[model samples]
Target: KEFLQWYIKEQGEEEENSEANVKNIKEAGDDLSAVDEKMGTRGG
Candidate 1:
């Protein structure tokens, strides 16, 4: 039971970290898109 609880906690943390990374990636992509739009390129 103790191991299972620890495993569950670890899994939850991994999921949270994954979500944060994805959000950061999305923000970076948006920044790149904005730059492209400003440059009047295909990203517009």
Candidate 2:
């Protein structure tokens, strides 16, 4: 019973971490695209 509870807790933490990582990656991609647009404007 104790082992099962610990395992469930660890899995929940891991799932949360994975979700945060995905969100961070998406935000970074958005930032990069914005920077690219800014650079393009400067060139023009």
Candidate 3:
């Protein structure tokens, strides 16, 4: 029973971390897209 409790806690932490990572990736992607657009305009 103790092990199960610990496992559940670990899973919850992992899920939170995963969500944070996803949010960071999305923000990074938006920044990259903006940079790409500027580069495209300059190239043309």
- For lDDT, candidate 1 versus 2, the one ahead is 2
| Highest TM-score against the true fold, candidate | 3
User: Over the stretch 8-41, how does candidate 2's per-residue lDDT look in tens digits?
Assistant: 6776689987677668779999999999999999
Q: Which ten residues in a row have the lowest lDDT in candidate 3?
A: 4-13
> lDDT of model 3 at residue 39?
98
Which pairs clash (backbone N, Cα, C closer than 3 Å) in model 1?
A: none
Model 3, runs deviating above 4 Å: 1-13
- List ranges where model 1 is wrong by over 4 Å: 1-13, 41-44
TM-score of each: 0.57, 0.63, 0.67
Q: Each prediction's Cα lDDT score?
A: 0.79, 0.83, 0.84
Error of 2 at 31 (Å): 0.5
Per-residue lDDT of model 1, residues 1-44, tens digit only: 99967766776689987677668779999999898788887545
Instruction: Count clashing residue pairs per candidate.
Output: 0, 0, 0
Q: Evaluate model 3: give its lDDT.
A: 0.84
- The C-alpha RMSD of each candidate to the native structure, in angstroms, is 9.7, 10.2, 9.6
| Superposed Cα RMSD, model 2 | 10.2
**Candidate order by decreasing TM-score:** 3, 2, 1
